[model samples]
Target: MNFGTLYRKSAFTDNPKGGNPAGVWVGETLPSGDVMQRIAAEVGYSETAFMAPTTGYYRTVRYYSPEMEVTFCGHATIAAGIVLGETEGDGKYQLTTAAGEVSVIVQNEGGVREAALTSVEPKYTGASDVLINEVLSALGWQPSDLDGSIPPARAYAGAWHLVLAVNDQNRLAKLNYDFERLKTIMLREGLTTLQLVWRESADVFHSRNPFPVGGVVEDPATGAAAAALGGYLREAELITVPATILIRQGEAMGRPSRLTVEIPATGGIVVKGTAVPIETE
Candidate 1:
């Protein structure tokens, strides 16, 4: 199948170089799963989004990494939203993924397109001490590096993420881990990413995501993980409802990105950010 109109966009930042780059393909019909996986590998981004119009404002969307297909991907969704807004005008779009239905709202703010996506019903589960210890061992971190304020938990928005909070920002900044070891454990535990974070303030936080399962060393901006973190905070009673928190990420990797997470009193979390086209050489 001939894939059409491939776009490269950076999510979570207005600047092309400041966020995670994702490949977006808007085709009349989506290709086979194998073909989609091949195209994603050829594009060589963290994940690529394929969209085919269904009826009205609904589209069938699938996310693929270089290695395999993911159930849901937040950054790619944001990038696809920007692309849709640029082509079809700013509006709300309903997308169907393997996980479930998602709603994305896109707006053109002074020529810069920004998008917000309402996640599926979020939930959390306690992380066993053994699992947490294994993950920490893979990361070369000691138990004392953790922040006691927020206990370890596995959070899910669209995908499952292991939430680990560090007391020091420096520990979060320096992310070097045994990729194979981490990947083995994560695959066994059915985890998508390790959401390592540090609190800068009540409403500000810094995060790093290890995504070996997707064949990436780290993700600059992870919207799905951000949503999961928000759910964890709310479910654990760590934050007040009707709050908006800012997450600063990718600075350690030099691709600085920002994601805003909005938590209501009840319901799904909203993750919002801007996306810009990446200039190719």
Candidate 2:
């Protein structure tokens, strides 16, 4: 049972201790879903990326958490990009995922390696009043606690997330919720995570993702949610077109991460970040 050459990389930050760690496995053939799930559980990260080459610069990729498989994952993708760049040389890699096709470009600038991933066609849908109310109750937040400017919606950029913006940064910092109850709600709604955010400026925001459905309490840095947010903001006419935004996450967790989101006039959102190898003894 040869798994592959596994690399441990931290995404969205150069400092190994300050980013989300992901396991990247690049191999000749991917293992069965059950084996992959078990391997991910053993890795014990938020997500692990499994990649197998399909053709030139094209690969089949799958994502899995400790508990189950996910359609897509942003941080893990970034980690894989860095690994591919270091091992296979910097270039563009086309990824075929369960949700859609994604492309990741790996580059080295001034000795710093970075990767940019363009998500699948992003979109959003209105959140039902019932669902919103239930989520709010689970989070112990009132309607007034929400930012009226950004209405509730279910946003998707490969994976689905419930976007809920707050007016206060303090409110975003103090995150505590019913784990089992929220997990149940998220599973029932087919949600990957809750994109909880607080806007600091027109192009800067603070984000926290509750990934109960993924069997994690919180995600330090979430690229999928950030891409979804960029699309939702534009589709909802909250932000101007052809804009770029900065997402600061994982701060509260002490593993700070930064994700750069570029929103074009019309297309999939592009997420840029840097990943570094996590050397362990």
Candidate 3:
């Protein structure tokens, strides 16, 4: 089947150099899983989106890293939405992803086209002591490196993420870990990424995402993880519900990104970011 224009987008930032890169592919029918995997590997992005005809006006979307399929990915959604908005015209695009249905609003304003996606219902649960130990061991991080304020927990909106908070920014900046061991733990835990974070203030946070399970070293702008973290914080009463917070990621990798998470007084948490296309060869 013929495919729409494939684009690379830097999610969570207006500049090309400041966010995570994602590959967006739109088509009538998805390519073989193997082909999609190969393309994702070649792209070498943390996540690549494959969109195809579902039933009706909705599209079937799948996410892949270099190595495997993921239940969800937020950065890739924004990228794909921008591609669709440019080609199909801007408004709301309905997607049927593995995580479930999500709505994306795309708009071109002041000659800059951007997209925002609302996550599925967010949920979380506290991590067991044994699981926490296993996670810390996998990353080769000692208990002292963790902040007790935000106890370890598993959060999910579109994907599963292990949320951990570090007290120091220096700790956040120095992100060296055992990739092989972390990958094993993440796969065992059914985690898409470990959302390592440092709270800057009541409304701001600095984050680092280790995504070895997805065959990537790090994620610059992790929108799905941010949404999950927000939900977990609210649900746990760690943070006030119905608040809006900003998450900054990828600065440690020099890509610096910003993600705005709005925790509604009611239903699903909204993850907001902007995506612009990168040039073709």
Q: In model 3, what is the error at residue 56, expressed in angstroms? A: 8.1
lDDT of 1 by residue, 1-281 (tens): 56588999999998888999999998888999999999999999999999996235799999999998988999999999989888898899999998899999999778778999999989999999999999999999999999999999999999999999999988997888999999999999999999999999999999999999999999999999999999999989999998999999999989999999999888889999989999888
TM-score, one value per model = 0.98, 0.98, 0.94
Model 1 CA deviation exceeding 4 Å by range? 54-56
- Give the TM-score (vs. native) of candidate 2: 0.98
TM-score of model number 3: 0.94
Whose TM-score is higher: candidate 1's or candidate 3's? 1
Q: Give the 10-residue window scoring lowest on summed lDDT in candidate 3.
A: 51-60
Candidates in order: C-alpha RMSD to true structure: 1.1, 1.1, 1.9
Name the lDDT value of residue 267 in candidate 3.
66
Q: Roughly what TM-score does model 1 have, to 2 decimal places?
A: 0.98
